[model samples]
Target: MTHATGYAALSAESPMAPFTFERRALRADDVRLDIRYCGVCHFDLHQARDDWHNSVCPCVPGHEIIGTVTEVGPDVTRFQIGDLAAIGCMVDSCMACPECVRGPEQYCVKRSTPTYNGKDRMDGSPTYGGYSDHIVAREQFVLKLPEGLDPERAAPLLCAGITTWSPLRHWKVGPGSRVAVAGLGGLGHMGVKLAVGLGAEVTVVTTSPAKSADALALGAH
Candidate 1:
């Protein structure tokens, strides 16, 4: 086991505190990453305060992560020793589940394992998140970083980008589709960009009139 440095809460109502924990030993199917950057998602704030009452501490809060692959399991093939790999809001899925087999893991029928503040499938240990120095996860949940994507800015894409991508893709928002994104923060911004890029007429619907210019600058009309 290797020790990791992270920010976590000791209980549901607590603010995050500096903490340390051990990374599980690498499994033959696992890839180890030296986490360099992690994005702060609203979910992290919610879970840290136990907004859902499911908070189990010490809750390490993060999922959007960017890092270098320092080690790979003997059985891993898609990644090598120095790949720029990423982990999103997911860590594992029940392989036997239908969605897992189909690659839409966000819909894993057995409930896809979350990246952090989740329970490990095998050890039952609480899965701490990426506000840390290292993480180990199944290769299925690891995404390869495309070139020129900044590690810091790119972290959020692992979650925000795909969440928006799915809906546009599912609805087939091609030419002539009218897409209106309700919010411009995080997920919503990604939604607008993806929809517009896919040839839809993207309208960023925002109550914050101040951000209107920013949205339009991002290619929304």
Candidate 2:
């Protein structure tokens, strides 16, 4: 077990406060990371506040995480100590399901294990999250941070960035494609940036005219 410290909500009405806990011991396929940055996703807020009515007490909420690899289990091969790494909302899934085999682990026949406010598939222990000093995740769920990317800025890419990037890629948005983003919030701004990068003509549709400059600066039309 590894001692970890982070902020946690003790109850639905409680604000997050400093809490100490233990991270599970390394499993053969697990990777340990020294967390460097964690992006605040609104989902984290919902979970912390028990807005979904299912949040467990001592909820440590964060998912968009960037860290430096500090250790890897014996069977791990994808990362090495000192490598920049990340973890998204998912930590594990049943790997034999058709959905998992095809790469969409989120749809695993057995529900995917969330980063926090979830139970560990192996021991049913409550899972904590990335708003901490470090974390342990299965090798399969860890991501390699690209060499030149800024780790601090890349944290949100695990959540908001990929959330938008997936649909854009699925639709094959590219040169000559017209993409209209509906809002200029976290996800929308990321969508605009990604679509523009994919060579699409991007447009921002928002009720707030005050955000026009912000939208255009993000490469929207």
Candidate 3:
């Protein structure tokens, strides 16, 4: 186990504060990252408050994470020291399950282990999120942060960006496709940008007339 420091919600009702805990030592396929930027999601608030009722305290809530690789296990092949890496909402899953084999492990048949508020399948250890100074995760769950994409701005790509992009990619959205996004918020805005990038004609139907200009600026009609 490795000692780590971070902020966590000691109780459902209390605000997050400094916390120290042990993270499992690197497995053959694991990479340890020194966290740099953590993006907050509304989901973080809900989990921090135990709104879904399954939160394990001391809860550290952050999934949209960007960091620099600090260490890699002997079998780690995808990343090396100093490379920018990102961790998303999932940390691990039963790779043998049908859902994982077919892709989209997020919908793993045996329940995908979320980045935080999840239990490690192997030892039942509570899995913590990225609201910390460092995190150790299997290399498969860590994404390579492309060079020149500002780490801070790119953090949300792990969640918001992927949330929108996955569906579009799955549906084979491309030139001549018609896409309509219902809101102009985080996920919606990213949907508009990606849809348009795929050469789709995008229409953003929003309740807020105020967001119309913002939508157009994001490349939606």
Models 1 onward score TM values of 0.95, 0.99, 0.94
For model 1 the TM-score comes to 0.95
Query: After superposition, which runs of candidate 3 have C-alpha atoms over 4 Å from their true positions?
Result: none
Candidate with the greatest TM-score versus the true structure: 2
Summed over model 1, clashes come to 0
| Tens digit per residue, CA lDDT, model 3, 1-221 | 88988889999999899999999988899999999999988899999999989889989889999999999999988898999999999988898888898878898989998999999888899998888989988888999998899998998899999999989999999999999999988789889999999999999998999999999999996
The regions of model 2 sitting more than 4 angstroms off are none
**Pairs in steric clash, model 1:** none
Colliding pairs, model 2: none
lDDT of 2 by residue, 1-221 (tens): 99999999988898889999999999999999999999999999999988889999999999999999999999999999999999999999999999999999999999999999999999999999999999999999999998899997999999999999999999999999999999999999999999999999999999999999999999998
lDDT comparison, 2 vs 3, better candidate: 2
Deviating ranges (above 4 Å) for candidate 1: none
Q: For residue 170, give model 3's deviation from the true position in Å.
A: 2.1
When 2 and 3 are scored with TM-score, the better candidate is: 2
